[model samples]
Target: MNELKDKVALITGGTKGIGLGIAQALLSQGIHVAITSRSAKAAEETAKQLNSSATKARAIGVKADVRDFESQQNAVRLVLSEFKQLDFVIANAGLGHFASIEELTLEQWQDTIDTNLTGAFYTIKASVEALKKSKGYYISISSLAGANFFAKGAAYNASKFGLTGFTQAVMLDLRQHGVKVSTIMPGSVSTHFNGNEPDSSDDWKIQIEDIGELVVDLLKMNPRALPSKVEVRPTMPPSK
Candidate 1:
């Protein structure tokens, strides 16, 4: 715990699942966190739930769609206005569409790529100036699909693969400017991703909190050391 007290963090898609988990983790560490989602109502509700009378005020939630550059830019502006300085950003807004290449519609492919890959680009691009000013950190939430393709996952696999490459390149580009970049690739997290209810059957999946804890760990690492990339998976899964 490198004492994240007073540090400001901006998380996209922070209203639920992995993003929410990460926001909660940062809040527990006394970090001033601001989260964004497409829905204004959801964001406000999540912020209320995460807020505390102690620990540097809870979190601020804003409405921003990752697929839109203007929306992401507005999110950055909101973070800067609320926190005065931005220390870290997590681009966690994404969607998965699973379909074989032959079965995938052109719209489906574009939607997945736009939301998962280009969305991250919008998020990071909008926040770069603030990050540079604070020598901050950028963490992209990737997935195992980024490297290991699965059946009927053409769209998802392509997006994650592109994201992984993009994250690495950004890491190299930002390091010299004092901004650290890293990607967290998690395997089968038990989240309500793709609009499914999270259930006990998903126990074999990595818990959302597991990813949150990893993010906390990354933030606490010494500035001189950058992990660059992390790949996480459950030690054991249910027998198929």
Candidate 2:
């Protein structure tokens, strides 16, 4: 039997892209998963697809918005009610709005910060107790933009930077409880973010499954070692 068999995970914004990829990977490793989305239809359909592909493990859909604390609390409650234990939580819901600082609207900036930064805060807060019980893991999907700044990326950069710092601090706060925390910072991922539809041209970028594999590796590592933060990038990119 798989050592991770029957472990459970809750993934925020898991209806598509990176979140969906991680759900699939965990299910394959015999982990039950609850995937949340703001859209009820997308969450349910994606869960159905994952269930069909998985062998022993199961998947469920939850309609939750990470930006709202109550909604995140409800998601964690529902997962614990169904799975009886929570072993991992991945904060993967995020968005980017690119424009010059002067052109960035207040609404865009707020949405970016709320969804990418505050949302992660809510996710971990909601799930922390459950994780402490299971000695589980928490992983946030941040980005390379957290460390690198560029014009027209004000909102995105701010959110990711804040998320990276937040996860590190939380790691210190939770390590004594036997819970592990880490943030994944990926560069040039081929996901449908920032209104960019994935296509063949994105082949050189990091695939969602690649991130999925990385999450699995982190979970499977020995408990004595903690990779507090990880930065991932495509091996090669078309030269400028």
Spell out the clash pairs found in candidate 1: none
- C-alpha RMSD by candidate, in order: 1.4, 1.2
Instruction: Give lDDT per model, in order.
Output: 0.91, 0.95
Q: Which stretches of candidate 2 lie over 4 Å from their true place?
A: none
Q: Which pairs of residues have clashing backbones in candidate 2?
A: none
Model 2, 1-240: lDDT tens digits are 126889999999999999999999999899999999999999999999998889989999999999999999999999989989999999999988899988999999999999999999999999999999999999999999999999999999999999999999999999999999999999998988878899999999999999999999999999988999999999999999
Worst 10 contiguous positions by lDDT, candidate 2: 1-10
lDDT of 1 by residue, 56-122 (tens): 5569989999999999999999888887999999999999888778999999999999999999999
RMSD of 1: 1.4
